[model samples]
Target: MKTYCFLFLIALSITQVNAETSIAILDFELNDLTLKPRTAAEINRTASIKPLLEKELKNAGYRIISIDLAMQQKANSGFGYLFDHNDVAAELGRTAGADYVLIGRLHKPSFLFAYIMGHLIRAKDGQLIGNYISETKGGDEKLTLKGVESIADKIDKDLDNRYTPPPPKHTTLH
Candidate 1:
């Protein structure tokens, strides 16, 4: 009986480890309030940042929901009006059956500097699980990707710390 119980416990632990968290990545808003005018190409490049973030998160072991599905759900649920509100994001996550949602903005104040800011919200209660900000010099594509990579690394670490089960305590025989 004791052997069967131990085997069952081990099986449960393995099942828990195999479960993957689902996440929804929203489109990043752009805030370029500087005097320098942005060309069409620049705006398009900025808009492309969200996919990079989604890819990074997916690579970090999260199952990322399709943005198209998220948008469709958002419109159906009347959450499109609330924009980036935490509640709205959480609702979208719920609609998509995701465990969490990631929302953020990219700000380019000038031609030389850019900032990436993001927030992770839990879908169950709309709690802010993590917030990250990264600044990188040079607003070019290479620099922007580098900045995003930095922010993604931080987010991955934060999520791992939050969701990873604590190491099991071991007992030593006296």
Candidate 2:
């Protein structure tokens, strides 16, 4: 009986571990507000953020739901469309069978640094769950990757905190 109980417990734990959260990460938009014109390197760096974020989140046990490029481009054509419209993002996530959707942007206000930002939305209800950001000092790939990693870590923590149940209250008869 004890052995059976132990085996059951192990199975339950395994099942829980296998139940990963599904998230659809949209392409990261580049919002360049700098004085200088956008360069090839800047465009390349902007393009890399989505893949890097997907990799980081996947390694953290998130099931990645890929959004089609054509659909994404078509739906989010205007400036800050996906990033600003959580409803559209949620609808897209639902269509893609994802529990959550992440819309990201790399905002460059100056030549010195840029902010990597994301909005996390609950697909079922279209609620904004979290807003995350990390600053990269320069246009280097390594620094941008680090910033992405930081945002990924924060998203993981926020999801855990929001989903975990609160401890039961203890009461004693006087």
Candidate 3:
């Protein structure tokens, strides 16, 4: 009886370990912002979008993760997050045993093109998961948020189907 119980416990533990799937959405790599007039005045809440992406993922039921401080430090010192941190994000995610590591690069139009172009990559094998080269375009950071929303919405929907965590509940005090 004890042997049977031990085997069942081991199986349960294995199942639990396999159930955890983590994903990290790095900062959106934005380029071409420099093209704007020197006095264009930066877009507000632009930095907040990254967290919004993470929130959207969490709301969709994905487990978010943290990268190493050293790698983060190096990545923070650049215009492009991956220019110096691509390998680091992947390596850190892998080292931390993440199932998916999401990285995005923004290729804003040069005031001539009509749409924003973005690159989203998967860290599993360092392959491009998807690209955002839409036909529609808008100028400035607000437009960029819309682009991000579109991309994040697609990913969140896919994740929603794959992993359906308990639906979030809202309650208001009387």
Candidate 4:
């Protein structure tokens, strides 16, 4: 009983931390392929993108904000339309009041692979901020997350830069 109580306490603390460092996850975009996504296996394969994205973001220390919360908090969810990264981040920040929002898109479909991209933007200003795009081949799940991690890492480093602005520019007459 004591051990169980300790575990529960630990889980609760982690949950609190996640809640504090909240991030909104906007919906992913999917383009229609030339042919229908047929076969149960193909359908399942096609569906793995979301799970992989969520896992990767979580692993990268981002507290994921689910669609449900986004809808409930913002009201009227997204109209199946994902805005640009900067717009998404600002809108979600106004809604969920999060520090950042990640907008993802998966387009131009092909067989045995999924090509996706993600962009992180600062909610305060509509800037490109950071971006990550990847094409995973041979149906490898690890590659999907690896791509995501690469992007996430890039965003992390950029965030650090944001706090420390670049040195003043010098324009001397030649």
Most accurate candidate by TM-score = 2
Comparing 2 with 4 on lDDT, the higher-scoring candidate is 2
Q: Which segments of model 4 are wrong by more than 4 Å?
A: 1-22, 37-47, 67-80, 160-174
Instruction: Give one digit per residue, the lDDT tens place, for model 4 in 1-174.
Output: 999999999999988665534456665655536376444544554466656656655655666666565463363245334444366456655566666666766554777666667676665665666677777664555555555555555555665321122234578998
lDDT of 4: 0.58
Q: Top model by lDDT, which number?
A: 2
Q: How accurate is candidate 2 locally (lDDT)?
A: 0.87
TM-score of each: 0.79, 0.83, 0.57, 0.58
Per-residue lDDT of model 2, residues 57-128, tens digit only: 887778899999888888886989888899999999999999999999999999999999999999998899
Q: Rate the local accuracy (lDDT) of all candidates.
A: 0.73, 0.87, 0.55, 0.58
Per-residue lDDT tens digits of candidate 3, residues 1-174? 999999999999999765645776665554554456222322333344567667656665678886665665565656665644455556656766665666655454455433334444456665555554543254455555555556666665444344233333578999
Candidate 3: deviation at residue 3, Å?
16
The true-versus-predicted C-alpha distance at residue 109 of model 1, in Å, is: 2.0
For model 2, the stretches where C-alpha displacement exceeds 4 angstroms are 1-14, 161-174
Shift in Å, residue 71, candidate 3: 1.9
Model 1 clash number: 0
Off by over 4 Å in 3: 1-20, 33-45, 68-70, 75-88, 110-124, 132-145, 156-174
